[model samples]
Target: MAIAGASAQSQTYVLDKGWEFSQAGSNEWMSARVPGTVHQDLLDHGRLPDPFYGMNELKVQWVEKEDWLYRTVFTVTADQLKSDAAWLTFEGLDTYADVYLNGSLLLKADNMFVGHKLAVKDVLREGENRLMIRFRSPVEETAPQWDTDGFNYPADNDHSEKRMSVYTRKAPYSYGWDWGIRLATSGIWRPVKLTFCNGAAIDDFFVRQQEVTEQVAKVDNQLEINNVISTPKEAQVKVVYAYGEQADTLTRTVVLQPGKNSLSMPAWIEKPHLWMPNGWGDPVLYTFTATVSVDGKEVASREEAIGLRSIRVVMEDDKDGKSFYFEVNGKPMFAKGSNYIPGDALLPNMTGERYARLFEDIRAANMNMVRVWGGGIYEDDRFYEEADRNGILVWQDFIFACTTYPHDPTFLKRVSEEAVYNMRRLRNHASLAMWCGNNEIYEGMRYWGWKDKYSPVVWKEMTEGYDVLFRQLLPELVAANDPGRFYMHGSPYEANWGRPESWKIADSHNWGTWYGQKPFESLDTEIPRFMSEYGFQAFPEMKTIRMFASPEDYELESPVMNAHQKASIGNFLIKKTMALYYKVPEKFEDLIYAGLILQGQGMRHGIEAHRRHRPYCMGSLPWQLNDSWPVVSWSSIDYYGNWKAMHYQIRRAFAPVLVD
Candidate 1:
């Protein structure tokens, strides 16, 4: 309820109104809502004759050179400004944005997933201040080359086929992917907050709890602070951490002389309690509060809720081959989970309630992990908070979606900004288990002639370029900021040249049935490490279908809808299925029951195959558990959010040392 990790004095300004928009380099402008997409405004005002028809075409032509400018004014009292540093933060902006304070550039960044913040120290005035922002949508030039392995290209075909062709390219949506929507907005989408701080401010802090022995826990704290005052100040930094009913508090005093300072604090807990995944036990989260005070007056503070547990992936060899298994504390544990996409495809509009419900459903299904797929935006703080509270481990992916994006200087710069910003925002959450570099980027690159594919000169250059970026630049960036967590080079790609020695897991995404061949039964006989992704889909519940369909149309819709229609249904299904999976009857009850049975069988087979292979097969996370936009493929649930039989099958399959 308190908007975790936020300061009490912080004022949330809704920059959801009064935006002026225009095409880039053009003088003509129109007024629109700050938090709404440009397409929505145009449709609502009837600016376009057929709002949905040729939407992507219009988006490509109009959005490329257009920039949406959002301007707003807010006044803060001098008293409030004097005590704490005033900071302006955007929860999210689409593609790219350049923010200005009274026409003075504050921050420039790309990648719609991460939030941005700027210090308004020198730019703020006592009475009123103007904040203007310009958002540039990703242009065709920003798209990767046509021949690039993951690049989706336009086919020479009729308009009817154009929609289907969009998915062939690697760009996030390729224009018409089912889970994707073509909407661009040049204004702020998420909430904007102004925080006032005093003395030294808590910049960042990360807590790592290691279960050294059954009775002993080693906790390490990394704290960073910025000293705003000129004179030296003696301050006490105390960390009070609690797990369930057990709590441990430690305090240390340090002398700070202006500028910046970083401190590491280590503490020991005897007979510390462990956090169990949902159903295993209560999700005992330790509340960590670090307070910095000068002369007993609290100057700055930071708080985080974390679970206390040690997790490691070990390679084991069995009769089948090498497999990967996760060791928690000291015992082997099976991971059951789903793949997650950004809460909303329409940038920055996801609500906290949405995340909460999703986590709750995941727990109800006996899942303990959620893989945040790479194609979507990095999740917000609220997402991590819910996962932490619910004992859900997060496998986070970087923003490099399905394919290779442009390696141009501008695009590279934007990628770096996105990386740094996301790392800074979500690094401290305890729920984050690992950071994956990209999803299938390397595998796709292999098709571009990196290994056995056609070795053209241009293809070589592209492959080498991505290799350097992923193996070198991206890893370096992660090391500089997020050293405590684990990182996977790219999902489903084996380690090759330029890969870091610190890379921990061998991840794979096998689609033996949907993408390649049928029978879908080769996972038990393939390569090792973590079986990161493999899945099959079923239709969602009727209630979920109803959300998108009109009352009259709802009667016409059921779980047996064609695959194409299923793809149009979004993630709203995960929520709809929660009630049904718990036996709460809704509309089309018979269809929901039938779908779940089919899904359950698929999950049982996949998990059984994965478990038979161990040590070499550290874990197996299905292709997806929920749908961002409902189409039928690997997801266990359909677009309408109905539980396929696979959902229950997964729960039983992932149970450790299953008997009978």
Candidate 2:
């Protein structure tokens, strides 16, 4: 549905066609897919083997070491080129890139997590224009930075030889994680767009829910308008709030300055319906349309949907330690869910349909929350939208995990920009619970023996860097941008899973059951204020395994099986624990079934134990809920979206009222 008031506001073109890519310095090019990667493009053109298949992952390791280039030709109208303001925007670029417009150097982008836009009116022409992007190999581009630092940051998850992921702003999992495949790929991983406007444009439009209740709801319709012209212009901003069979209108007329002008219009609605979480009430949403008109001619417009609700994290001190829980609408709520990794190693493969199915599975399994684990890309907008519609809360982590980063001014500035951009993009979502700094980074600083690996001077500098990044920079950014939302320095913030006293306080990631070889029964007794992470490994169902392995490759020690098991201790621990629970089965498929049962029973015990404690233990989010590959690891759902036996058991364990 188009906005009723939209007219000559702006003319935009999606530059997604006529794209091609080649190895840097090579004339041979292949038709490329935007919002894609070099690896996927290579495989699609039959130049490379399927990396996810058995042992073929080893064959495509050369792609990440070579730089790549992508180019496209787009046409623009004479009127568009004559506009007072014209801009080119790339919604995402894979790590290091240099963008050019019509052969003129335009911008250098270093972060994959944020969009980059530049004023290209002077560079763009009326006829055909060439746009090019050069994506430098992430490993090669960051190697010099690592060398200059003179000391290595401990990036255990990076499977690459140099471990330079800490020096790059790309998804850390692309370097490799315990559960993800190593594919440090590069390309134009998102859309490229061009826009033309005359007076001003809507930079951001948010319906800030100031106060909400059954009686009345107060809101401030905030608009950030960017004036592209040289002088002040008079503009009328009109906003219409619409719900089922109801609508309210608010209008403001103001003189916009040469640059960004912040404006807000306060309004109220009587008898407003509140947005509630899963198993609570309905998650009602209302839409708002805002239009900007200059001299009675509409210039820009935006439409957004928001939910009215209030949420806070309650952490008052209790007898054992500080209580950690989320308070929604003045009621303390228990979060029952699991950690979430990326749905696919190749991000573009995760489409809207995939996200819908994933959330549907989450709703069907009775999950109320999902921690978007750090290490993965900040998911597509479709993900959070689904969460809002399904009444599932989201725990978002800043994309830094399992490693320390440089605190140089240049590095910090990039991180700050990344933080602000993502915060602004996601702030209005009702499903967003809080912003966590990173995953396990704080714990790594305290308990991972990082200090022993460096001199006292180096250790002091590293520790101070951590404090600056997590304690000061990230929290300050959160306060400035999304003040109404909560921010945690990191997950398992005040607790270490290895320490006995840690369990009585804050959140905990109890790896003892799997990493420490502790029995499944230990989860029953070693409960915490919040069991944020704990799980046992399991193979995907036999059907999923058969997709990647041949009949002869079904054995645990086969080469094909080893290629799929990314975790160092994955196969060993599964076999070790299997012998303890049941007789080691001779049939390979039978053993796969047994592994699923073993994981299900272990997770069920932990989930039930956490729920049995009720108000004392407020959350139980297991190690993972889904997989990025068909492998033997800790995920209830596999990469093909097949539910392992553990998912069925988790569905039962997460019931609102579970007996025994």
Candidate 3:
């Protein structure tokens, strides 16, 4: 992915080898891997037991309490040193980290949700160089600050995790989600890379296909070039576009100035092939390459693949009714899918093949859309790439979830930067359907006791923060930066979180079954326009449970089993629901197998019920799609990639065409 510019010498080296790690307070250094975690490294060195083992997580809670340090040394060869600039880049840093290169402070990173790249020429030499990163405890990093009204809201530092994940720019699930392991990781969770490039280089580029017809399509691209040299240079930028076997090139000449220069280009395709979602048609894709050359020699290059399509969110409301649906290629269609979360707690270990396999399972289940929940990372690039190729749509939520966030200037500034970076990063994908503000912040404030917890002044500040962040700042940023795509303020709400008849204007999450203990038949009684979130919990298969439970401790009340089950009443709920459809099981295996069928029947009932409502119920994205840890939850697929009974039932219920 090197960009060719005036100087044809651009080298990228993955700095993934020869690393050492230790607890921040300890000097006992251990071998480390760049793209790994403190837990993985500690387990590798036999310093701790498996957190998944029976009642073992309780023993390893020490890992999250202390900061971790990673140090490494790399050499810049004479050839690489010849380049005019050297840059150090980190695709990811778990949460809060301070980086030092050759004993000079480089940068202090506070967000785990985005990547960072910056110049390091002055810190490098022709020989060996040292790099060190100290990751602070996420709990300490996100501690509630003392303000005029004491702590703004209650610090949600629960017993399991000291970190108030809602206060930090880190994955919320890392701090004990209902269906996850609480192993707050620290380290370079993504690849560390060093690049040597001379003069100008293409930093990033994005393409937007605005309109498409049978014979032609209008596509626009924004290309950004970072020129380090102070003197202007004559640069020729060529863009090559290929569809199937046909390829064509377009070239433009421009003067490259110092700092960062961004430009735009337009391209039209003849006889353009349109992209479609699952079951509608084939998801056609095209390849593209951007190259920068000076004096007729290629200096830098970027190659990528994309799909062509026109999409719009139709929302027309009047006094009587409101219409909210996705129109692709001018055709309104029903959306059937499930909410998505982090596929794995060990994020760096989630490979492209893993994403492909999981998504294939989704397609097999006849789902077309997946909601990337706000509590997790924006997801790795491969996820959107596969969604594009597989004809699946993505509903992305900004990284704001359950808890009320601070309106302090520092927090707002960080969120603003985070939004801008991700908006530019992910706006181009054709599979990206819509943008949502948060998961359930409004519900928490209005109904979940957030208002009761705050004083009058604090409540005013909190409400203002919510409005500014979700209502104003986020939407304005999206409109100014990436137009055309629809941005919903929040789910299960209209205009704001509490507008009357919100279900008619936005999606709804019906949780009567799990929270209210309503009968399994309740899904048929009350429904909404878009049934976005509703689910029944079931344990991971017996095989998955064995990973964390011992054979002798298979009973529901056993310490191993209880320790693994997160929801306080999860087992009771499952047992109670299972009895309605199935006879009481005498043994553990029977209960486990019967639980699968019980969950399947309940979820499939809701799915079918939602689909039966048709235009009245435009979409069905159940509570979740996959699991981050092996425990009883709503996920249809288990941690080991085994499909529970619900997977098959969902496949049938969500069939592209079903006969009633």
Return the TM-score for each candidate structure.
0.78, 0.97, 0.95
Question: lDDT tens digits, residues 1-660, model 2?
Answer: 111132486877777788899998788988998879999999999999888888887888899889899998888778767788988888889988999888799989999998987899999888899988999999888889878778778898875556799988888888777777888889888777778888999999877777877788898888999999999999999999888989989988899999999998999999887888888988888888999999989889888878888888876788988788988876888898899998888888889999999999999999989999988878888999999999899999999898888899989989998998888888889899899999888899889999899999888888899899999999999988887788888888778767988887778999987889888888888878988889889888888888888898989889999888877888788878888889978898888889999999889989999999979899999889998877778999999999888899999998878889
Candidate 2 residue runs with Cα over 4 Å from true position? 1-7
Tell me the tens digit of each residue's lDDT in model 1 across 257-376: 787889899888787667766556666667889888877777778888767776665554445434455566677766777787654444434567767787877887777888988766
**Which residue pairs in model 3 clash with each other?**
3-300, 3-301, 4-299, 4-300, 4-301, 5-299, 5-300
The clash count for each model shown is 39, 0, 7
**How big is the positional error of residue 450 in model 1, measured in Å on the Cα after superposition?**
8.5
Q: Determine the C-alpha RMSD for candidate 3 after optimal superposition of all C-alphas.
A: 2.6
User: Over the stretch 1-660, how does candidate 3's per-residue lDDT look in tens digits?
Assistant: 222223355878788888999897779998997689888899899999988788787788788779999998888788777777788889889889999998899989988877889789877887889999999988766654432335544324244333266567888777777777787888899888888887678888787777787788888877898776888878899899998789988889999888788878899999878889998998998888888886777777776777888778777774536666788887877888988889887787788899999889999899889999987888888899999989999999998777777777777777887888888778878899888888778777777687877678878988998898999989999897778789987775542223335556657788888877777798885667777788888887888887878789989788888877877789998888777777969799888889888888888898888889887778888887898877778989988899999888899999988876
lDDT agreement of model 3 with the native: 0.81
Clash list (residue pairs), candidate 2: none
Worst 10-residue lDDT window for candidate 3 reads: 154-163
TM-score sort, best first: 2, 3, 1
